[model samples]
Each structure stands twice: as C-alpha cells, then as structure tokens.
Target: MSSRSLPRLPAAPGTIETGSTLKTLLDREAIDCLAHNLARVHRTLNAKAFRREAREGIEPLAILARGQHLAKVLRRHLPARYEQAVAVLVRSLTPSLSETEGNGLAGFFYLPHVSFVATYGLDPAKNGGRDPFEASMRAQYEITRRFSAEFSIRPFLIKWPERTLARLREWTRDPDPHVRRLCSEGSRPRLPWAMRIPAFVQDPRPVLPILEALKDDSELYVRRSVANHVGDIAKDHPALAFELCERWAEGADENRKWLIRHAVRHPAKKGVKAALRLRKLAAAG
Candidate 1:
C-alpha cells in the first residue's frame, strides 16, 4: 500500500512522543541507525534506497506497520535474492552473544534489527530462495539469543511444523532464556497481534511437549512465555489447559505456581468451569 493510503496509527500506551507517537520501541532514529549500520557492514547496501525508504511516509505507520514497510523496502533494494540479503543483515548484527547478558538501552538497541528480521527475513518465497529454511532457522536461533526471534520463528512453525517443533523441543534446554522463551512464545496459537497458527488452535498437541519441558523453567521470562502459551490454548480448549495446569500443579515449585496462576488468569476471568476449579485448587493450596 502507498504511504499516503496507509492509515495513521495511534500512539501506543507508554509511548512518549517526540515527533510522532513512539508506541513501538522502534522509532525513526532507530531505523536510521539500522540503515547506517547495514551500509557500514555491507558497502554495497543501497544507502540511498535504504534512507529514502526509511523516511518516506514513516510518520503515519505504527511500530509494527513501520517494520513491515521497512521489510518491503529491504526486499526491493537489498540483493535480489533472500539468502544473500539475510546473510548480510545477519552478519551486520553486533557479535553474537555467548550467554544472554546486557540490559538497559544496551539490550534495547537491537529492537529494530530484530523487528526487521521477524517481519521480512523469515519468509522463503518472499526471499526467492529454493531452500532457505535451514538458513532462516539458524538466523533465528542466533538472533533470538541476542534479542528475540519469537514472532520471526512463527512462519517456520507454520511452514514446517514438525521440524520446527523438534528444534523447539531441543531449544527448551538452551541456556539462553531468550531462546527458551521463543520455544514457547513462537508456537503460541494466539500470540497477540501476530497471525494465528490454525493447526495449533485446532489441536495444540504438537506444542504440548515444548510447554511440558518449560513448565518449571528457571527464568521468569521463559516461564511467562509458557504461561501465555498455555493461556492461549486455554482460550480455545479450557479442558486441555486445565488438565495441563493440574498436571503441572502436582508438586509444583514456586515458579510453576506463578505460571499456573498466570495461565488461568484469563480463563478464570471468563469463568470457565475448569479454570474456576483450578483457581479454587490454587487458592486452597
């Protein structure tokens, strides 16, 4: 859609407007920084195209919409092929982390880069590669450790459910909380604001193993993803959500208890019978 045709988005809650609504963590400066860095890493990166695309009609688009716009621009101006474009972008990232560290603005700085990959780099057909699946998966694994690949990995789960699930099962043990969190968050059937995975919504059995492994994760971040994932499931399959919560509730740790409470919050609010029962059990304990 043309920039003029795009609907102007409202400022998101918590946004502090300098020029436009800073609803998304990403802003114009971040976009400019990304383009500048991309050009730095790959001299051939079309600097003019990148800058023009970054500024054109950006004021109207919301954070997520802006990310999508940037991705289209990248596809147009970057190398004609997907693998080549993604490789350059991936290489341009600040050195990969050995262990999850860094916080404050240091960590927050990667948001726009992560947003670009999540929106643009995950698609195989869009990139025009014969088989970029493995490359995309590897890139997600690397990027997630630094920032997060949750939204970016969903397309893989939808396109290659079995392989993606298998990889996620392994990722459950990844030392990086971010990767572990992605295992649960990326597979969520109803992850907010992203496209739903119909297969998961229909029958979430495929994702059960990943959640089962993450129920007692040491990191609150990973555990939160687990709770949210099961909660998404609970919206559609209350019985199943309750069953899992009940199963995990047995000899539950403090962490598991927090997750259980979070998982059922929505259901309990909606007054699902099983959720109410689970809440009662939780209260009694």
Candidate 2:
C-alpha cells in the first residue's frame, strides 16, 4: 500500500505534542546523547524505505527514538494510554511495510520495545528467509524473553507440531547450522516471544529425543538455545529435565557441561551440584 493511501491512524488520546515530546527528551543530556548515537546508526545503515518514509518531517531518528521515549514518558504520565497508542501506530503502519522496509523499521526501533510489534505480528510476511517480519521477530526474540507470554507466541508454536518433531530429527545432518538451530530453538516452549505449547512444556517427550540427538551439536548458538529451552522445561517440570540431563551427561565436554547447567537453570542447588559432578565423571570417563 502506498504511503499516501495508508490507512488513517487514530491519534492516540492525550498524546503530548510531538515538539514537546522531543524537547522533554532532549533536555535529558544522557537521552540526547543516546539519541544522537542511535540516529547515527540509523543514518549509517541508510535503509532505503526508512529514509524515504522519514523524510516527511518526522525524523526517522526521532521516530526510532519514539518508543523508548514514549515508554518512559507515557508510562509515568499516562500508563493506560501508552501501549494503546503505540499499538495503534504500529498497526497503522503494518500495511505499508514491504519485507525489507519492515525489517528496516524493526532495526530503527529499540530492542526492549519489540514486544509492541511481536504482539501484533500483523505483517503478511512469511516466517523466514529474507522477510522483514521474520527478521524482526527473530531479532525481537533473541533480545527479550518475556514476550513468551502465551498470547503473543501461540500462533507460531502450534503449527505442524509433528513437522517440527520430524525436522528436528532430520536437521542433525542438515549441514546448515541455521536450520540446525531452528530445529532446536524453535521448538522451545519458552523461546522468548514464542507461545508455550503446553503439550511440549508438560511432557516434552517428543523433543527429549530431539535434544538428545542435537545435544552435542557442533554449533554453540544451537546448543545455547537448546540448553535454555531445556532450562525452561526444568522450571515447569524438573524431573523430566533432570532425566534428560542424566541421559546426556555420559560423555560431557565443556559444551555438554554448559548445556546441562543451562538446562537446569532453576533446579535445586543439590541438583545443580550433582549435575556438575556428573559432568566431571563424564569428562573423565
């Protein structure tokens, strides 16, 4: 959709004038400096769609800064309206974003505030490849974990569940670490911003085998995400996670040790110490 033809966005009620908002933020010397740094980054990136859209008096840098500023300002002054306004603006812009354009916008926005976009996921873009929505979501997921709220991630979590199971098994030999990571990471019940598939969190039976298959995965990133995932399960069901740790602890290397520690992040200290001892024994054996 063309910018001019973009849907009319409702002015968020009680929005302080843009000039006043900018002024207040600039008055804070630290905020001003950070804004300058972020602006420089945005300009250096020279994202095409972002620059073009930025030209209409709303400095892209300022727009980029809006979320962080708004989150702070509105939360203190108008908590009820802050999220609503941000949500409206994001939804209004959704139709206008192309794949790259959307990613560019995602880059401009600060990381902590990515939940505003992930909560919507209104973009029609596909899940992976070069799509901006996909990139944005991946970036958002990597940064924050709370968006794992059930409402936010439910859609992506339940798709072709069996397919994910099959893929995880097949991915161990896929050569591409990205796919390998996806196989383990995407199935995570607490994969930041991803919905908790109760079935997986409750039983995690199917995935236990998959993690076993990929536990010694050569890729650190894949193993890290896998470890964290198992850690998530440990919160909900410790016994299951402990069992998996024991099963995998036989030949523990540093990576395996790290994985076990991560997988048991919230377990009792006794459990953690025991796991460590097991790691030592495995390493020695």
Candidate 3:
C-alpha cells in the first residue's frame, strides 16, 4: 500500500519507466479522475479546488508522499466530519478487482484514499474531539479491496494495538483475499516501505495468532503474506519463528511447505541451524 503490493513491488523512488515516472500515477489526468470519482459520490465536493491544490507543487513528490499530499487536499475539499468524508472516499472506489493476481498497477489509483485515513484517521482528541476509529476501520476494509490498506492500517495498530489486532483477527476469515492479505501484511513488524510495528518487533506473540489462522489460507496470495510476516518475526524472534514453522510443518501441504521455506529463507541464509533444518524439511515435504 505504501508503494504497491505483493508480487508488484512499488517502483523505486524516482524510478523512470520508458520516460514516464511512478509519480505520474497521480498526475493531472489521475487527479482529474480522482476528482471525478469523489464528486460523483459526494455532490458537494469542490472538485476543481481539490484538483488545483492536489496538483500544486505535487510533481516533485514521491509516490507515497504524493498520496499524503492529495489526502490533505481532500480535507480541504470534502466534508469537515470525518465519517461523512470517509464514507465518500469509500463509495468513490471503483469496482473491486475480480482476482488478486496480475492486477498490474491498476490498484494504485486509490492510494490517496488510504493515505487520507492513515494521516487523519487517528485520535479524535487531535481532531476536534470526534473519534475516527470505527469509521477508519470500515474505510480501510473497503480500500483494501481495491488498493491496500496495509500502509494505512499500521498507524491504527500503533495507536490501538488490541483493538486493531482484534479487528485483524476477524479479517482473517474475510471472503476477499486482499482483505485477508492486509491482516498479515498490515501488521508485519518490518513491512517494507511502511512503518514498523515496534510492539511486534519486540514481542511478536500478538501477531502470531493472526498468522496462524492464515498459515494455510485457501489463497496463495494470502499465504505468501503470512510467510513474509513470519520472516519479519524471524528478524526479531528466530526461535518463535522457527517454532511456528515447525508446527506448520506438521501435516503440511505443498503450499504450506512453500510458506515454511519462504518464512525461514532469510534466517537460513544467515546460518541459523534451526532455520536451515526447517528449510530442508520443507524441501523434503
């Protein structure tokens, strides 16, 4: 979500593609398209001003920074009430992707929407005494279906750990693979291009349950995230990661074996004997 999703890593900062850059994703045309969607959903939005402000000095900003920029512009142009404003962003989302694979860069269009929630979707005390927790959760749920809420959901985990993790537990069972992937990807202790969750890096127990539920997920898209999340755990708690991988090794399927291998690959490369053995076992499986 910060830049892109799994399988499609975000473009390198200032990465130029055939003379076009990643920031172009939020260019004048993209801004107009975004303005069109928001205006369609909320009749009162000042689309013209939104475009002008969003475009002003936006060219030099990197991809994620651009998202934050437009999000702030949204504050100026949309409803003052957080709930009403978030509702509009949610409703403005284009049709959800039919399948999670091979989506290319189409999902990046909604980056600003999730950025809106992440930057402003925090404590009401800072925001005129109106709590945004419930609305933010609902907004991320919808946004993850289209783009990723992985980047946006991290702040919530930092502010409301127990509350956010509880919501993530429920999301493990969501019908959509993207939502399920967010549950793992969003909570990783060291998610790339996103802020780290210090609590999980210090003690990963809370995140374990969520990963356990998704260890053998029906979709490889979700399960691959589980593997990467475990790798994050390995960085801090190798023993815990190895133990979890050992458990997963029992009654393992081919997909799960892959997860175990991916989960321990980094540690194995670093000469962790246990991880090496585990990787070998997964290979044998």
TM-score of 3: 0.91
Residues 239-266, candidate 3: write the lDDT tens digits: 8889999989988989999999999999
Off by over 4 Å in 1: 1-20, 23-25, 95-129, 283-285
Deviating ranges (above 4 Å) for candidate 3: 1-20, 125-128
lDDT of 1 by residue, 1-285 (tens): 454332222223333457745334556556666676677657887777777877788777776677676777766666767777777767666655555433423333354445656665556676774677766777788777766777678777887889889999998998778889889988999999788999999999989999999888887878888999999998899888889899888887677887888899987888777887776666534
lDDT of all predictions: 0.74, 0.48, 0.86
User: What residue pairs clash in candidate 3, if any at all?
Assistant: none
Best by TM-score: 3
Between the candidate structures 1 and 2, which one is better when assessed by lDDT?
A: 1
Which should have the higher TM-score, number 2 or number 3?
3
Give each model a TM-score. Answer: 0.82, 0.46, 0.91
Q: Regarding TM-score, does 1 or 2 come out ahead?
A: 1
lDDT value, candidate 3, whole model: 0.86
Encode model 2's per-residue lDDT on 1-285: one tens digit a residue.
455443322222233564554323322332333233333323332233333332333334453254444334322321133333233233322222222111212222232234344433434332222323343334333322211212323444465456436645775566655555556776777766445687787777777776877788887766886888787787777767777788777657778877776666555455666555544444532
Clashes of each: 0, 1, 0
Q: How accurate is candidate 1 locally (lDDT)?
A: 0.74
